[model samples]
Target: MGSLRINKVKYNGDKYYFESPVFTENVILIEGDNGTGKTTFCNLIYYGLGGRVKEFLKEEARTHKEIVNDTNNYVDLYISINTENYHLRRFIGDNDITVSPFTISDVEPPTPNEIETNLVNLDGVELLPVNRSFGNRIFSDWVLEKLNISVIELYQGYSTFKVNFTELFRLIYHDQQPNPELIYKQIDTKSNYISDSELLRKAIFEQLIGKSSSEYYDAIVEAKKAEKEKLLAKHFLDEFEPIIAHLRGAEKVINKPFLMTELEQKEMQLEKLHYSREAFKNNRTANTTIDIALDDSKSIIISDEIGLSESKEKLLSLFDEKSKLFFLKENTAKEITQVIKVIHAHDQLNLFSADTCPYCLTKVERVSGHCVCGAEIDEQQYERFFYTSQEYKEILKSKTKTVSTIELAIKGCEEDITSVNSDIEQLTNNIQNAKKKLRSILDSIDQPIDIETLNNIDDKILSIREQISLLNQKIELENKYEKLSSEYEVKRKAHQSAELIMQGLEVKAKQEIVTKVNDFSDVYNLLMTETLEDCRSARISLDTYLPVINDGEYKEASSGVSIRLMYYLTLLTLSLEDENVPFPHFLLIDTPETAGIELSNLKNCLDKFSNLQSISNDYQVIITTGLSKYPESLANNRVIYLPNKANALLKTKSQSQPL
Candidate 1:
């Protein structure tokens, strides 16, 4: 069935009546130059064809700048689709379109419909609703219906210039550049109050905790990234911290006087040896030194002193023992022997004892044993050797000094060992800390969900995926089931309506759908003239999805001009032979001549278009174009001239607004 047509259009409280002839043929043309009110006239005709024109005007009227705009007082359109049929009368005087009046009056075709609130027959067959002004209905929906196919398949398989807004606007009427996304497509169909897809999914994911596709991907990615970073930090810590902790723990043994070094231990041992030697010296019965100078250079000596008198012991104790390393036995045996070893560290001699020497075997040795030799040498015998004795004492002092220095130096080594131990302890503590970090990182990575928890997410995703899958399958299965159901319903209704052709019993107007009224060869010939490839039948099969380049690349039916043409030709060819169809045979097309289409293709298309206007008075076709052309057989078609008061290329200037 074809769309309802409008024959004549008029308005109340207006300066003039804008008139244009209705087109009902295979080809019709409406011509004018650019900026000549062609778009306005197109809108007018579209408005008369059950489009929401007055409503669009009302919306435009409420704009903030509309205060200074001219108001539409009243509007009306007379529709003539069939000569013996009805005329549709539509009125839009009221400022509010919600209460605007529209009625259908019988003229020549059939009965009139007066009901309100959107007029349509049952069974879901009705005038298509427009989303935007032109691109929505005239292009997307109407074209698909004319081609006798679904719109979704046609759009998915589209292979041509992409349908952005600029191209779309240029197609209808050359204007400014249009926004890319704003050019509507089936996928972009949306309501005024629309929510973002990602945002909606985010909120749902937050509440549901991982069910949707986006949620699954987002959660997985987030967890993986977070877990990976955490693990990376922990992995670094794990490598360094153990060594640090180990050092920290081992530092205890190194910090202070654990004094475990061999050198330090040996020094302590030497100290003990010194103390023992001193004790032996203190208890030994030796020639004690009690010197009192009498004359010139001589002194009396009483030796057999082990521990000295109180005054002498006090004097000895007051001296620093380190000086003992510098003293030595002298050659003045009886003279200096009593005091030679006084400041020294060791007394290998046995005092007041007639014993053999510990190192050399000399019998009955006394004070002489304290010397390196065992002979009782006279003072004069040793007198010449004084300088040598002095040198000899220096050598003994240097030897003992070297041993004490070694012991003292070894004492310092203990402290360094303590510091190394402290370092080990710190390292040990660090290691422990690192282990803790590693554990936490591991936990976060795997996200340890119990089997039950995992099962829940799995079940939900499976359920949703299954639902989508089943819905798809059911859609495929629905065709067969629906066909059977419809056939069954038609047969079942026959019992109710006795005169019905298939099922229903109600007595209604005789109806018929002449799918293709023209000769198949003629229609093919007309359609093929516009193509390079050999053409087949142009009448679309019930299952066909329009022209395609290959088996895959399909032509879009949602095109402003193509759709209009598709729709017009569909009805024209269907009613061409006998001229009997359910809907109007006449078509009123607005100016499409200036849509920047190829001149040859448009003419070829128009040629096929003109063929629909069967020479008889049964069918009529009228079209508007910016390029003027009056066909030979259709000279009687009316011409509309909008007042070109000034520059033809200028945009419609707006009047200044009042404050």
Candidate 2:
């Protein structure tokens, strides 16, 4: 990753120019009193590096024309990434900015005329225009590419869902405002990019430390292999076991290759039996006395049977219609009763009003000795009162008409049902008489061999043939089971090896993070000399990245700034030295004096940061705090200090006017 170093910060006002400290060391302190634009200074640094201007600050500036008492002001940041240095300028009220191909020495203070212009461009400048599309794609894309950070996909193919430069800065900057207990709350702001926060954090951590994209990918591969093997094993058992079991009960070798030949021979025998039965029926069946009896019965009653079927269908139709009418009448009666009750209740409630208002529970008084609220002695005079009764009467009349129509339909359905029933009874009697005559004729004559007896014998032969075919299928299934079982065992062993490998990789990553946390804890104790008893067992939470002391979050501590100082310092220090961390190694902490840390403890915190600066020249650490909050230890480290509100961050009107 490329190094980000702020060479200089220049603020241009209409009548004056304000400049920040010149680039000197890795660790710099901006000491000031409250309302000294300490947070504003930090936010400018953040915004210059493409970090989001917090919603609260933007809203404030929107409501109030001037921000931090600066009107029509813009800032210029001279920064260096790795070996290259560039001057980035952004004007107020515009989403566009220009970066010039120049050094910090080349960027002089802007003239009064230049400050009045909108987005003043220098020679050989590159316009970094802001995109209003999803994820601010073009802006973030250019920034991340310049920082030498990879443009990795969080959810592949969804261009908007990717890790952004703003999120990376969240880890590097801690504003003056105290965040929630979560250490990663800096990136908790909602955005179109980074839909899954937890996954994005994990990806960021991996990218920083040079780890693979996902540890679960290997586990997923192993699980899928195991699942396929399981299906193979189950298929053989399900398809073949029942067939084998049935064959074994009949004392057959199902797996025998010759079983199909035996089944074919039985099928041929069954076909011959069917042919024999058909020949027997043709030689002796219709010549019998029962055939003659059946013919006579059919001729006499066939027409009457057809009439009976039609009458039965008509009766069913009439019954279905009657049932629908009956249900309709019942529901209509209930609805009419409900409407009547509602009308009666409404009429009773409107009878007369007491000398009071029901809503307010207050005594009612007539305006100029008359009912001004429209309560009348005669309801006929009230249009609303008269309309309610008229509407109810109309509704009742409509319901009564509906009820009369249903009753008339029901009566017609009943009459039709009676007529159909009479026809059905007469037809049924005629058909029964014809069947009795046929029975009498058959009883008089006898037949020796019947067609039923032949059919029974043929059915038995067919059943035996079917059993033989089933046994052959069982034999084939038994052979398949043996083959798949061996394959399943081989696949199961491979799955087990993959699971062990996945577990080993996870443990290695966890141990590396744990070691970094131990180093952080040591630094924290070095800074906090007057430590609370509860912080004795403080450790950084791997999940939330917050301080966990005695199984509780360190954020809940009485001294808020002290805990915040410890957290930021520990993370910065650990990231600086840890080879696995891909941290940019840049930290901008707004205030470390809030929540009332002792002056001695605050001095120790600054001294600790100063000491860490000697470890490497690769990173920068900037801190802002109140002047009286620190001891003499931070005197040399302080860059700008505000003594009072008059000489605060913003220039007063007296200082800017004609000076």
Candidate 3:
């Protein structure tokens, strides 16, 4: 989240610790008379952060940065964020740095806990994710349920292998912008057109249009309500219908009243009499009146407080062959039979409808929902009866047996009808509830999707994805074709362009670049020299040429525009470079302002490198010089001065150095 500082090692060889003067001004002006180790501090900061400062230096003679590169046994770094401190350190044993940092508390960099990895690597570097989450920023993953990029995109955009939101801040810090001038420099400086165009359009589209993944994704998001509604519909259909059917079928029984007639009650008494007669007759011949009835038609079935035995309800029951019979009320169904000493008080069977026994019948009371068998029937259904059917038959006739059999069949059919009707009611209830659920889902904001519809949509989406995949393949083919075509053009054009430029005065362009490099060197002379006359310039050399090359007897051999070309190409391909590398948007220039006695020549060199760093955006130029050697005409901007000498301190010196 913030910059890290490494061994600003304020100590020299044997010092216990390094102490720094306050960096009060964030715009650091690290000036110390002349030999104040300002460059040494810079070198320490640079090398401490894993930068190769000597590579940028022109001389083979080493600075402390180089010395640190060679013999440094310790490296440290401190990070500042949210006004808090974090530190990292590494020590040299055999070779390598440790993978993960050994973190320290609220302290500045170069902690004392570094360990040596003792591994040597010359080929490449290892990159590892940081141990701590990025917390100083306003963006994080916890804010969203899921996403490809962090919320930082709301302000700056997310990072990539190349440019993104964090990089935007860095650009801001460097005062860089993609203004017209920089764009031109980027385009004009690039030597390769294919690299300029490849992947170029994609970046432009992202900045201008954004989220190539949003087309189908956004569409599905928009349709979420409808999809949820469909799912709700399907759920309702599956759950509610069967329950409703059961309830309806159960309640319908309340509407269908059952009744028995007087004649039926008399028949029930007659059947009992027949049993009693048969039992008595079997014991003696006087039972002739029941088996071979004499004038039996007028016998008038009657009983004086006659009672039915418990087993007499079974019409053909032989177990009660010795039991007496009771003059039961005909309205009393066999199922409602109960124990009684007397069956009647009237010559006419004195009875209301008989009620079934409690435990034997699982009848449930409507009000309290207890079984009617266990509960008293205080309701009106107990006393009421309709004369639906009746019979007054002889006691011993086969017709009684046939009627009993038919009654059994009717009872069985009634039970089956009730069961089937319950099923139908359940199915109907299911259908109704299903409809309700479907309607609810249909009206909901996020409709539940139908399984069938979802599958269909999935198929459609799959088809679209397949089409996009095919399109991607086509794009790949087109890219390969374009690349091959560009290669053909490059090979074809290189020869023609070279031959044309070679024969023409275009070779003079190489001479111009050589002169420019030389002019650049002249600016450096003013710092090392005493007088303008002693500032005679040196010429520049290049190993390669652009558009033309000549090995002219190794004497008048001309160093061509390759240097200029390399510089130009770097500007052009800057977007594609590994962005992790360091670059100061506005360069800190060491110029030969005093020694380039030819003002025109110095002006010319200034014009080129200045134009280079100042391609566009917010680049600046800061030149350091002394009043005695530097020319006044060229110091158009604020010129920093050493003021006096003798205020320098070196942080790290060679272990055995003689300074």
Candidate 4:
């Protein structure tokens, strides 16, 4: 990773102007008492380096609109990343971003300022705009590109998650804001809802230690996604299987009103066919054997008995009339039953106890003809005319008579139909005999079958064909449903396999990362002061990635701030020496001495910063603190000193500037 070192910061415009001393040493401390713009100065360097400050410092920026003297005021940061110097400039109250290469003339602003045609000239400096819609990604992208840092990718939820250098700055720059509960990944401004906090903490640790593999995690996530889709598709099939089966065999035309017209036409045609069959049977009775020659010739008898055609017609008409009588007989029987029930109920009502009214439950004199409630005594007697047994008996008798008459009429019609049938049988026998004789007389003659028989055979064939067509349609639908079901099952199993592979990779990756974290925790303990010697055996919590001292969390310890410094410094120190750990090789810790600690322990903490050169040859550590708090040993490391808030790094319009 490319190393970043902030050299100096300059603010000029309107009525405010101030300049910070050049940062030369590897470990530079900005010392000042409280409210002396110490925090503000550190934050300016953080913001100038494209470090994300909105999440933790948005409220501070909003409250202090006069951070500069005027809205058009500007702050410039002269910094070096990987030995290349650059000046990053920004309008205090605007969205303008500009960067230029370092020049001798750029060391400081001129005494008499020169007016600009636009906000700032882009002749030499590169103008970088903050693209808010894309997460202000443009500025971070440019910084990372210059540093030669590749974009990192990891799996979060169902998507491939991404993080740029701007996010990494949150981990590197420890601001003045105190958050005892959180020690790592405090800035949650990104999409944090999708991943587990514990799992992501481990994942970040893995990434820094060079144990993370984007391809491996992404494959696992993709497989999980496929599995979910397959499961959904399978469930869809299971839910609709019954419906599909019903649809396959369903007779879609059964309830159609349009089919009713066709049914009526078929009924009429069937009736006509029946009439034609009867006519044909009657016509077959004709004597066609008269032409046969006989040995004793006698006049053929022409007796006039009832003609087969007329008898058949009379039988057919009687059958039609009998059907009506049968319906009337059934109707009359129902009416008779209803009337009988009514009469029985009336008789039961008439037998109610003599001197009491059932509805009012009141007593009555047998001969008084009235109840106490004004209800008529013997009320049944007055209502007898409406539902009298005699009237009921009359209606029953009338219905019974009508039923009997209809039955007799139906029986008479049935008798006539039976007699006609017997005569038709006889006529059929006579025709068969006549046909035999005619065949004998015309032994060499050819004969044809009846037209009605041929037409009946054709109609039967058409009906059978229609049934076959319906059966074929049902079979087609069944095949279609089966094919769909098979495809769903195949895809479901494929998704399951992918999910298994993803889970295996995750388990393997976790094992490798835990080993490295244990090693780093040991180094962290060594860097702590002797005061924490008893608890120096503390390790990074595998779950939270925070320091765990003596089986207890470091955040809960009395020297939480000091422990945090050990954790941050150790991580930064490891990043410089170990090729496995990826870090910016830069640190901006606000205050470590503010925590109540012994003077010797405080010196040990400051010495840790000074002692980093032995472990790593390259790194920058910047810390802000009060002058009176830190040990005298750090006096040589003090890069900037602010006596009070009035003469802080950022001079307001009211403060006077030195000549």
Candidate 5:
């Protein structure tokens, strides 16, 4: 639906320059003889738009060595995309192109002369690099964006590749290469990132007809991402399934509440065991008389323990205060050193000549105590403005005094810490002694239960506690497994939904392509019948989008050149007729008469090409052919005429003629 029209093409070199006449017609013809740079003109247009020209220049070196050797040679293509003017410039043997917006004082579309004079002063120019490196801004993507076409990714093998503008232009540009059996240009698969396969060809065709939209590709990408996430979740679950099973077997519980209940029960059992052991000792001792002594010993232990805790806390507080004082003292010392250095720098500056002002480099005069600038030079005020050496010394002395004070404080704090440590040690010994006395008082009584029975109870209690801890751990793992399972299900459903939406879009796109292809075939068959000598029938294959002539494949056709020409014309005609087709409404056919077609059939093809203007005047087709081969009736379409190789499309300063 987008429109691209080349208004002018200018070729500049160190010693010569050539500019094409402003293209004001839909069908522009470049009629030139052999070896007259007709193909060079076409290649310049391609190169100016950021197409590769290294291989092209290498092949044409013998014929166009002068233009190649001129290091300052570059081509500028002035074009309008959807009524917005732009200028694209690319030098020979360069991998990048400079694109600038073409604007001239209130002109909707500036003339080529205005562009040439004002292009250098224009703003918003961008340099687009052409390469296949990942994460780089590519030139083709910019062209596609300007053409209002969405770049979509196509799956190739295990990787995905977006269709570049070069790939799309191959279908639009019908070169003079002899391999007419190939529908598209022969892609060098080794160097090219995208392979020349059925998938690519179909994708190109689908894009041209507006089938492969960005929305469709977005859905596909989302579906793939969701599927990947779902698989990751499943993998995690599979890897941890054994661990979950092991936890379940060890805990014998599935939930947190059950584990909590078991833990509480074990704790209660432990408390009961302690109480029973104490009661049994108490009953054996009949210790009502010693109860008071026991109470006093317990009180003493409690009091000593509290005192020990308080002393430890005090020691920690003193240590913290000492650490803070050390940090503050170190920082203050650094500040004093920095101030002294500043004072020394200021003293050094005073050694400079005092007759001239350092800032203004002018003579200085003092009247009384005032400076040359009429500012009072009070010594006390000057000291306030800048740090004086004596003042800095005083500051350093003060900082030293403060450091001494902090040292005293730290010493005091260390003494207090040592005192607290002594208190803590004494309190700990007193508590231990109290506990020993209480134990002896109990041991003096007769034993109510044997030691082996108490040991058995303690072992059972420890086993129950261990079981409770294991149950808690298992409960946490089970909860995690449940959460992961829920996540997996959600991802799986999302992926499935995305897949369905993608499939639906695919079906709708296929239907649209089918309708467009049928329309394309109508024009193609008509052109083939009129242009071919013995053409029985011609139709584009639905699957491959290639022409099939006389019930045979493209390669099987008797005249491949005729089929190729008709194929290009058919696309042009379809684009003009259908507004939905995403073609740029532009075609570049370079020397189509190379493959030796009959003169009558060639003229028929030319007539079909000129007839496109009747459908719509919104398209531009630039075709190169020999002057003698073109019919005389369509002479108005001839925009450029090259008499011979002497007046080629590109000429050097030594040459006197013009194109």
Candidate 6:
């Protein structure tokens, strides 16, 4: 257990000093009247221990301006913690305190001159600032380290704060504040660092009683973070469920294995369609070869038909020439007959003239070889009247020659017509056979192939391939969903494990707290019943750790002073009896008789402090009160006595002179 004890306290000014009686007892009393600076004496000790008593010091300086305004005035406190002796000095109106090891004997109080010499020439003294704004070495750090207490950090709302020595001192020092119902020092509302939260109050109590530790609170914060992460994972899973389900539904509709099979079937069908089209093309190529030959045959037939038409035209021309020759031959034969008749008539006329006149039939005589009618019987006359026999014969011969020429032309024309008819008939027969062969070849080739059917097969193949592509995408989505689900499961298990660990630690800490609280309540009820006049029952609350009187809420009353006083005494008593409690086992209470508390009740409360001392000599309780109110039983515990306002705790000169 840790311990703190005050050995000596001295007040040093420029030309004078006032020193306290040696505090060699566990329970010390400072008895004085109202104006004698008893509260000032108590506050000096508080200030020397790194407490913020500036406000109280201001009030004290106001009341005793002459004594406090001394520029060279300061307080020196000699103390020991855990058996290590030290000296602390604090100047008036200063936030800095000087601390150093004291090797001098504190068995006897130092004289004024010795203290003044020590204050002027102190070595190895460390100056520590009490102001939090300095951000340097603090006075609490030194004191708390000497007391073997670790600074604790607390998390409240969103901000983290530290529980310092000043805050913890609130429970140790019960002040002369008028609020008697207050269980702890009234929270300084003007200070931003202090909070009026019940959470902070409970945390301070838990720290004092050793019910909570930094490690335990750290576990709680970690558990909450894990829980938050787990919920986020769940939210992601819930949001992803619909998208995963939609992809799954699409996969179900398509049926992957079956879709793959159908794709294969469609591909095979497309290949067959391509093969069939190729075969049809090959057949058409063969038919084209046959058609080429037939085209050659038809070309020959067309040539023959042209020759036949030319031959027929030539035959008709020959027939026309033959008809003209026949007409010329008949006309030439008639001209030959007419020329013979002319010649015979001329010979008959010459014979008749020699006998008689042919026309008159009288006997006639030739005169110069002429007829009597003056007809000339000479060849010249015959030439003029009719053709001569030789001439007639020549004419008939020329006519006979013309008739022969015409007969020969008619025969030649008939021969050409006969030859042309034969040629025409042969050409016509050849053209007829060629047409029959062309018709047979046309019937032998197959029909044209359907192009539209190939187009339909291509469209179906493309459609099937698109469906297969969609199925592949769905499969990929499903894989991603599986991975996410696996991660979510891992987070879930981690959250569960963290929650179990936090619960176990909490359960163990609570069990210890309940045991200590029960022990504390027993001491508290005993003190309350003894101190209050009408006290029926009293106990410490399990939840708030406040005093409950007669199964009711603690309210504002004069008796609350006794209740608060006993509550502090119970804490001090528990520190002695309970090993788990971490209370410093020291208290500095000032004037518990305030708030109009009854004199009898105040005496009962004072007796409780004596009772605690009887139970254990390991603790210290320093209390100040009016001299008239001081109980006779605790007279042995009185360490200082100020008779009246004339004999204040501090003087202007030495102890020989009054201010």
- Highest-scoring model, lDDT: 5
**TM-score versus the correct structure, for each prediction:** 0.32, 0.49, 0.23, 0.52, 0.63, 0.54
Runs in model 2 deviating more than 4 A are: 15-17, 54-65, 68-72, 104-124, 129-137, 156-160, 178-180, 185-189, 192-196, 201-534, 553-556, 652-659
Q: Per-residue lDDT for 206-314 in model 6, tens only?
A: 7677634433555676676676777887887788878867756644444446656665776676577666645543223355568687889889898998898899889
The lDDT per prediction is 0.35, 0.62, 0.31, 0.62, 0.74, 0.71
How well is each residue in 1-659 modelled by candidate 1, as lDDT tens digits?
33334444433222233333433333334455665655555544444343443323535543312112333223334543332222222223221111111222421222213223233222221222333353444323443244222222101122211122211112122211122111111122222222223233122212111112222333333444344455554455456545544544544322122322433554455455545433332221222221111111121111112222333444343342323422321122223332333211111112211344445435453464244355666645544433322233445446545656644543443443354445545544554554554443333342323545445545555555554454444343344344544544554444333323222211111111112222332453355434323333243222222222223334332223433354345434544444323223454555544334455544555556555544444554556554444344443443443334232211222322110
Name the better of 4 and 5 by lDDT.
5
Off by over 4 Å in 4: 51-62, 93-96, 100-137, 145-150, 153-161, 179-181, 188-196, 211-508, 529-536, 553-557, 652-659
Model 4, global lDDT: 0.62
Error of 6 at 250 (Å): 28
Where does candidate 6 stray beyond 4 Å?
55-68, 107-125, 133-137, 211-505, 553-556, 654-659
In model 4, the clashing pairs are none
Q: What is the C-alpha lDDT profile of model 4 across 1-659, one tens digit per residue?
A: 66777777876655666777776778888878787777677766766665545523435544444463354355678777777777777655444456666443335432212323212222444546543444455666677666655455455555655555555665677665455335664653555553335555555555555434433456555786676778777787787667755764654423324444455565566566556644433222223443444211211211112355666788789888988888888888788767755554343233333545667635465555654456665766744435434456568668878888888888888888899888877765665565555454454233343657757755765674565455455445455555667768877778877877767766776775677677777787676534464564677776667777767743433466667677777778877877656666888888665446665666667677777888776788888877666767667888777778655676766676531
| lDDT tens per residue, model 2, 1-659 | 55677877766544445577676778778877787678767867776665556431445534212443444455668877767777665654445555554532434544334443422223344546554454454556666667666666554332335566666665567665554344453653566555446666655554444333234333534555565676777676667667667656867444455666667777777788777765555323345456766887887699888888888888888899899999999999787766655543333233333444556545566443244475445433533433343356458568978999999999999988888888888888888999898775555454345558777877878787777767556655655666666666766676677667757755765676566556666766654434443455566556745566656643343355566666666666666676445566678888766555667666666666766756677888888888666656556777777766666665643474111
**Strongest candidate by TM-score:** 5
Question: Could you tell me the lDDT of residue 411 within candidate 6?
Answer: 88
Q: After superposition, how far is residue 33 of candidate 1 from its true place, in Å?
A: 1.9
Model 5 RMSD, rounded to 1 decimal:
17.6
Q: What lDDT is reached at residue 479 by model 4?
A: 55
